[model samples]
Target chain A: MVAFIGQLGRNVIHAIAKLGDASIFAVSTLRLLFATPWQGKHFVMQLYAVGVGSLIIIIITGAFTGMVLALQGYHMLVKVGTEALLGSAVALSLIRELGPVLAALMFVGRAGSSITAEIGIMRVTEQMDALEMMAVNPQARVMLTRIVACAIALPLLVGIFDVVGLAAGYLVGVEMLGVNSGVYIGETIDKIALTDVYAGLTKSMYFGLLVGIICTYMGQRATPTTEGVAKATTQAVMICSVMVLVLDYIITSFYL
Target chain B: MIKTKGLTKTYGNVAALNDINLHIKGGEVTVILGGSGSGKTTLLRLLAGLESPTSGSIMFSGEDLAKISRKRLYELRLRVGMLFQYSALLNSLTVYENVAFPLREHTDLDKEVIHTMVTMKLEQVGLRGFEEMMPSQLSGGMAKRVAFARALAMDPQVVFFDEPTSGLDPISAGVISSLIHETTVKTRMTSVVVTHDVQAGLDIADHVILLWQGEIIAEGKSNTIKNSDDPRVQQFIEGRPNGPIPFSRSQTAYVDDLTHKPGCVRLE
Candidate 1:
């Protein structure tokens, strides 16, 4: 029992130390945003990598998720004789909840893991140390640009996800299931408030920041070995996915 | 010029380097010779300010590197250069871009000027026509040469090399050692090299420091190191396995390890 308690305490302290390192890294890197030499080239590269690179996956996932949600909603609503409400149901869920959550999750798998691997490999290969020797601040050049790019890109990508998802829901519910097309389109317009979008985009923006910080932190602290880079990549993806789901719940509670 | 006073570095309770006092003269090639795990690379890293010393100071140009503020040290590093064992070229960039990276980053020089400078550095390193090739396409020696060009991009006053000859053929290694000798003579840059290859170290080094178990065991001119009477030094240089530095560094006896002694843990 004493040994077990000691082990537990050691793990707790390790966890706290890791948390502190990550917080310091994020805050210091973000502080570079206000500095001069605005890193325009690097920022644009990251937007291409994190935003444009993940475009197709996000669209495909959005369409399929909306179609599935609509199918499930139609069965349950038809039982209560309120099947006409399917459009509003799908719109509210996609706009207020699923859009941001699923988009963030997809971003984790698509971009976040690749960022971690690329940075982690650079760390392992001593390229980061080489950069430091050349007096290039890797934080400003690598971390700051990536974090800001993800923050900007996530909201824009989530907007696309919401639009595509709602359109897919419309295709399945009105065009195929024979629900009134006008009711489908009108209910979607009537049900979703601008505030719902603000909330979802807000959640996505925060998820973007969280993914950026966690992935970069893991990569930056990688142990400088092949297995180390692989582990950091896996940890980045897993942690970003889990955090997106958990934060989605917490932010949704605020809306409620 | 660079100097260290009783410099030491520790990871957990084990010291990687200990009580190292040395001075490297300006515009000279100094080779730090040691076997693996003797902390030569650790000392190089400390001098580069990549890792802080646990105790003592690294003095360069009247400033204590150990005590310098982080921001100040980064600024100071602009005058320093490093060539890694693996060459550490930015794999994503072409040869021209990699060599031009430091200049493009730190200077407001026009693209034309940067282009001229990159061309000159690459030409100096004998890689004049390989400008558009990626690092992945280069041979080991070629990659190392490109890295030398990159290290020279800023015309740094000092350059540290970590095991530059490790993964090369004998001819390539000789070419690199001669290149180091020629570069230092031409540029007047202080050079610190870490390597276990005694022949390579002796070929180029004007000054040599031999590290054993984290401490400076012997240091002098390269010939002095070659002729040293110390059995440990002889053991390393002559490649005799049975001597002061044993092959297996395991603290525990094999039996104790198998029997699970208090401090002995099984290998992962």
Candidate 2:
């Protein structure tokens, strides 16, 4: 028991130290992000990769999620004789929770994992060292571009997801199930405030920043080996997914 | 001109480099020779400002590297260039872009000037027509040539080559060695090369330093290194199996291991 406790303490301390290091890395990158000689090309390329590359997955996830929510909510509302509330339920869920959380999760799986792998490969191949030798700031050139791109991309992606999901919900609830199109549209608009949309956007922005930082940090700190790169990529995806869920809960609890 | 004073680097309790002092002259090829794990690469990395020493100081043209700010260090680095063991070209970039990258990032030169410089450097490395090719399509020798072209793109005053001939055929190694020699002579740039190849080191070096167990065991003209009295130096250069440097790193008794099974065996 004593040995186990000692090992546990050591592990906890190690984790805390790693977290501190990552925080410092993020702070330094942000401080150098706007320094002279901006990397406009890299930023634009990353924006295309993280945002445009992720569009198809986001659309599919949004559409299917809305359909499922409407199907389930229609059954419950019918039983309660409150079928008119179906639109309110679907819109509230899509805007307030599902859109941001699910979009962020998918981003973590797709863009975040690839970013980690790419950076890890750079480290393994000595390309990062090469950059340093050339007197180029790797943090500014690599991390800052990707992070800003992600931050800009996530909110737009969340908006798309929310819009697509709402449309799908309308198709299922109003057109297919005959829930009354006018009532559904009117109830959804009445129930959703501007603040809910703002809240979801805010959540997505934070998620994007966290995922970018964590993935880049993992990749930069990864050991220079094939196995090490693979491990870092997996860790980036796993940690970002968990962080998105946890942060979503915290933000929702406070904002709602 | 570069010099080190009592330079030491340690990883935890184990020292990768011990207290050592040396001078690297200007406008000459200086070769650092060592067996594996002899801290040759570590010394090169420290000189290139890629790593900081645990203790002691590195003076590059009279500026102390350790005391300088990151910005100043970066400025200092712009005057230096290095070729990595594996070429280290940006895999995402085409050959033309790889050589043109430093020029694009560090200078305000117009596109025409940049293109001319890239073409000239590639031609110097004998890859003039291979500009649009991706790094993945190039052979190992071609990749190293491209990396060399990239290293020279900034017209640095000093160039460091870390195992330039490693992972290449003998003819390719000879070509790389001749290129290093010709480039250094033509540009009159200070060149530092780290290698284990005895013949290549002797053939191209104006000065040579041999490292053993994180310490400089020999330092003099390359020709003199062959006749050195140090058993370690002789063992290394002559490639002898029996010498002060043990071939096998087993500390346990050989007979005891054979007769009775030990609790655990450590492999180095």
Native contacts retained per candidate? Answer: 0.88, 0.85
Docking class of 1: medium
lDDT of each: 0.91, 0.93
Model 2 DockQ reads: 0.88
User: Could you say which candidate leads in TM-score?
Assistant: 2
Q: Residue B138, candidate 2: how far off, in angstroms?
A: 1.9
Q: Which residues of candidate 2, in runs, are more than 4 Å off? A: B262-268
Q: Residues A36-143, candidate 1, lDDT per residue (tens digit)?
A: 478888899899989999899999999998998899999999999998999999999998889999999999999899889989999888888888888888888888
TM-score of 2: 0.97
- For all the predictions, what are the DockQ values? 0.79, 0.88
Model 2: CAPRI class: high
List, residue by residue over B21-42, the lDDT tens digit for candidate 1: 9999999999999998999999
